[model samples]
Target: MSEQTAPRTAAGDSTDRPVDRTGGGTGRGSGGTGRGSGGGDVGGPGTVGPEPSTARGEQTRQLILETALRLFRERGYAQTTMRAIAREAGVAVGNAYYYFESKEHLIQGFYRRTHADHVVAAAPALAAETDFAARLRAVLHAGIDVLTPSHAFAATFFKTAAEPTSPLSPFSAQSSEARTEAIRLFEEVLAGSTAKVDPQLRPDLPELLWLGYLGVILYWVHDRSPDQSKTRLLIDGAVPLVDRLVGLSRLRVLRPVTTQVLELIRSLRH
Candidate 1:
């Protein structure tokens, strides 16, 4: 359902916390800021230096990423190269590789950046809505908003990411970090909601919601309608059905079926 339809509670009225839209976080490839000179040895092949520590270094890293995305949009993903990105970003080719090893890695950076933006964008809605359906709808809408700028690029890039063997695939090991973070966002949506999810199903629900989100993205990639309004309609329509199913999970009659579905999910994980 639309944001206008979602119910609110006193708890949902909490003030919003500040979010770091700067794409800073700890962990390899999490875009954590590092400490060091912005310039140094580029390092030999097969070896890379540390992440950007200084503000200047981080700025440089962001510059390269921004340039790469622009070029990816101007040109096609396949047509863009590291050298071109470095040149456009006004950094050495090695510096581009320093921040991101390959074009695939650049897309990974895009994933992290977009997710971070989605979190920031959804903070207001999350802070203001306690209904599970509303929170889910807000987060999903926030995701589409964050992704709208890259829609053209995503359409082209989907070909590569669709390949099972491609590192760009969302399900690939290379994408585990971003994927995990996305699932966790949904977990936050569930955790803060008033929905009484079945205890057995609670743990796996976030990933399932994430998969549904992927379905939405896939539809969005092909959505040629004005402003992708169709995709928004899809979300508005589907969330209530999801809410009903989640609500149904608490019924004793559905427990056995939920158990089976959980078993199926666990089996597929291995």
Candidate 2:
């Protein structure tokens, strides 16, 4: 599947919000870069000692992460530098470095936590439902729920990623294998589904659905509705309907259109 074909819920990363992909320097949330200043170690080397200091270290790290998150949102990703983050965080540049290697490294925290949250939110609905259609709907809704909170950041990030040269682009060489692994995990979710797609297409379907999912996310990113109202509508209506359509792909009449769409997507990827 292409990026646009990925099986994504209405809630997604940067793709979910609306922002300018082109480098206008003024987008949604944040998209800036800078360097760190004030050198000091806030969370020094971890010693296998008492729990109190560990808790303190944890709190400090959280503070930095939270502070950085805010700054990144307020400023652009490119403008938010390590130095700026450290200054705002009330810590030394070395202290921020102790926790994260660079601003990009800090961004990874957003992706990592987002995926973890996706599973947590989806689990409950998935567990309660037995029908494949219902389960799929729950999974999609869960993803959307996790994503809504970061809509602003999500839009900016996706916009940045659309650029082929951006380091943060999903397909960029700079994207760590670990991040790709996250996409792989989402693929696993699709594997667990009971959607009656072609057996031959199963392996590729997850990737394709992921791409499709991303396409909707691209739309969601630019959505400006109150509470991203349009995204909610997509979740409530389009998703389940697509799920049903996929379930019905085995029908002879629809097969031609499906094949054409899939082929079109494949062409774009190449």
Candidate 3:
């Protein structure tokens, strides 16, 4: 399948042209500033304003985000700056900061957008497949497809994210929004599958699968294989084992083990 590209500006260009401020600056209620008067609150000091509510504002926001991601890919995350992103995006530095407070926020936006893309890409497979393992495989492959474009960037970004206390860590509180949404996607995967899971394991299975996916992503980051083919093989090999284990969870013999696992997970959370 062809790689899915990031959303582009409405004009379908990446030129460094200034944002059009012809009508009240980007959108209605924007007060000639990038921030709309009644936009969604970002809830932090020094933030320009709430998120843009108008279509034009949203387009501008997307343009900034796409530009940031591109620069991050080319310049490496540490070398890229908000000024550079704003200059490349053709928006004012304040405007760029208006959309994303910092580089960390931009990465969070990357996390959110990539997950959203994964969901859209996985929808077809989720709708067409009922078998547990097949559905799982489809979702996993879809994730790789969505991420394929960013593989080069991801390789370097992994170093910062790998730090246990870094906000970039997928398990960090700062990344909770993206993490929660990703786990929710796994829940959908399990919900639509035909597999009969243990009643007690149902609630926790999605999180377990999401954690497994993080492992897959880690492997993919280090995968030097052409086109990350080895990661694909890993997924293909791992899914059946996961499926079998999930299926066995319904057996009475595994109930105690499943409960112990759940208890351990809960303990770690606190």
Which has the greatest TM-score? Answer: 1
TM-score of 3: 0.82
Report the CA-based lDDT of candidate 1 relative to the real structure: 0.79
lDDT of 1 at 217: 97
- List TM-scores for all candidates, in order: 0.82, 0.68, 0.82
Clash totals in order: 3, 43, 0
User: Model 3: residues >4 Å from true position, as ranges?
Assistant: 1-51
| lDDT tens digits, residue span 5-76, model 2 | 123222132221112233322111224321122122342211011121466656656777788788767876
Model 2 misplaced stretches (Cα beyond 4 Å): 1-40, 43-60, 176-185, 252-270
Candidate 1: tens digits of C-alpha lDDT, residues 86-162:
66877545456667756788889999999999999999999999999999999999999999989888887888889
In candidate 2, how many Å is residue 230 off? Answer: 0.7
Per-residue lDDT, model 1, residue 214, is: 97
Question: What lDDT is reached at residue 184 by model 1?
Answer: 95
After the best TM-score superposition of candidate 3, give how far the Cα of residue 158 lies from its true spot, in angstroms. Answer: 2.0
Model-by-model lDDT, in order? 0.79, 0.59, 0.79
Q: In model 1, where do residues sit more than 4 Å from their true spots?
A: 1-51
